[model samples]
Target: MSTAAVTDKRHSTLRAASLPRWTPWVIAAGSLVLGIGISMAAGLDSQVQWGLIAAVLFVLGTFGVAARVEGRRQAKDRVATSLVWVAFLLAVVPLVSLIWVTVVRGVKVLDVYFLTHSMGVVADTEPGGGIYHAIIGSLEQVGLATLIGAPIGVLTAIYLVEYGRGRLAKAVTFFVDVMTGIPSIVAGLFILSLMLIFEMQPFGFAGSLALAILMMPVVVRSTEEMLKLVPNELREASLALGVPKWRTILKVVLPTSVGGITTGIMLAVARIAGETAPVLLLVFGNPFINNNPFEGAQASLPLYIYQQFANSAGSGAAFDRAWAASLTLIAFVMILNLVARGIARWKAPKTGR
Candidate 1:
């Protein structure tokens, strides 16, 4: 090669034709407009149909335009990205819509007064009632279930992770797997059968037992995973220091994975918090306040909502109460999730590079 040609080649940069950074947004807007026009022209009234058309058009347009400009390889990558965005919007739009609708309908009856009073002496067909009793029942029942389930679950997980061996361990693992898939209604029925055998009446404690059954497998699975995340090096170090196995687990392993374990327990609590069938089959749904969970029927938010909606005689008041109770339950679950996130972040082991 000549010296001038070699120098020119070293200094030159290869460039390919590519779309602008804003090309996707422009394509999406155009597709949306075209989708709406097509839907209207075809006399289709479904917004979902319009959205599907827009998503399809956007993906097709991106692939075609990118292939023409940037080549087929880049076009396929763009198509994958487009597909991801479409799936994300598909998931998010319905969730946003649900929360929006719930908030709008819930605020009609949700107030401080609603949170403070019971439905004592109030007809389900009337407008004057509150979820105060339900709140009390839910708190007590879930608290009891947690107290019952969390420790046993954690201990079982510890056994599985640290000391599991032989056929016993296999049996425990098998049962945990089986329990994880047991329906809430089956738990309720099992408890119900015991109550019948003992000639007992519906009470809040019975509901708590069912919730505990539904809660344990989730706790066990999550806690087992968290315990496994604790590095073997930590356990080995403690053992090398002449520490007892139980003490080492308590001091080193448990502390290291405490955040994840706590998060799992909180999530388990949230899962059992919204259960209606167990509460219905056991607690029997009270209309008035019942503070003692052991002795009598009690109300829960889920049961309250179900009762109000199912029993109302074309009454707007009952429907409003159901929505308000739903809002409260959602708020409670959201708070638990937020708290779990906070605890996880705060107690998570700090990493150093």
Candidate 2:
């Protein structure tokens, strides 16, 4: 308030700002030098030693400089923030590397022909064989799995959410949790055994059934979560209006939860698309294109990858094809996720006064 007091406050603030910003830089550099010295003194391997030395030195130097200029508290905060960024970079590097590798390797082998032919006639000597048959089989088997799994999963979820209570709901939940952790091989074995018992023979249909079992628990859990998130107020309002419980569920609840349900289904599909054990055991890959899943053996991308990599003659081509198939699978999942997001956005409740 007084002139002298105001002047004193301004001077104090100016004095506080006078410390050199380069203090932290100097400290970091000194720490780095010390780290290098320690690494050298210990006679550590060049790569590991140098890397550790650099990292330690950088961290120490950062703290030293920050503490000198910004005080201990601010310096710790700065170091923590920098460390977090470094951690994030570390996590992201692998994902970026994987995508880069997949795209680079996959594009080299991808072509129109690759999408249309099976490996049946293509010799390892030739370079132009396609994955057409494999693609079709993947679609058919996965499609059938969707058909089989979606209904049972949706119904189970509906029951759990709408009618299940106490012991029954808890049992379903526990079993679903258990099923979620079941080995993929076990599902294949179960289906294979069942087929053998029924004298149904191993085929693409059997693979579908196995995949369906694997997918159902995932779908049920996801759908149940989504359904539970639906506002109870909406259901109550519908019932208050004299809507039958089933009609209210059909007209309001289902519509409200449809977006999440679609997303869940897509997730389930994506989860099982690359499954190898079931298809390998049940469908058994064929060299020729087999559009009829019920009738005979069908080749899936996973089995195709396996066959190619297993044979010495086709190893290189198969490896290339495997990477390409991986890329395709990733793309498929990405597209499904995008579509899920779109559907969720479109179906989101309209908000207005």
Among all candidates shown, the one with the greatest TM-score:
1
In model 1, which range of ten residues has the least summed lDDT?
Answer: 1-10
Q: List model 2 lDDT by residue over 2-73, tens digit each.
A: 123224533343223223566545655676577777877887766545655665666666777666654666
In order, candidate lDDTs are: 0.91, 0.80
Model 2's C-alpha root-mean-square deviation from the true structure amounts to 6.0
Off by over 4 Å in 1: 1-17, 313-315, 350-353
Give the TM-score of each candidate: 0.91, 0.80
Q: In candidate 1, how many Å is residue 67 off?
A: 3.4
Q: Which RMSD values do the candidates have, in order? A: 4.8, 6.0
TM accuracy, model 1: 0.91
Error of 1 at 312 (Å): 3.3
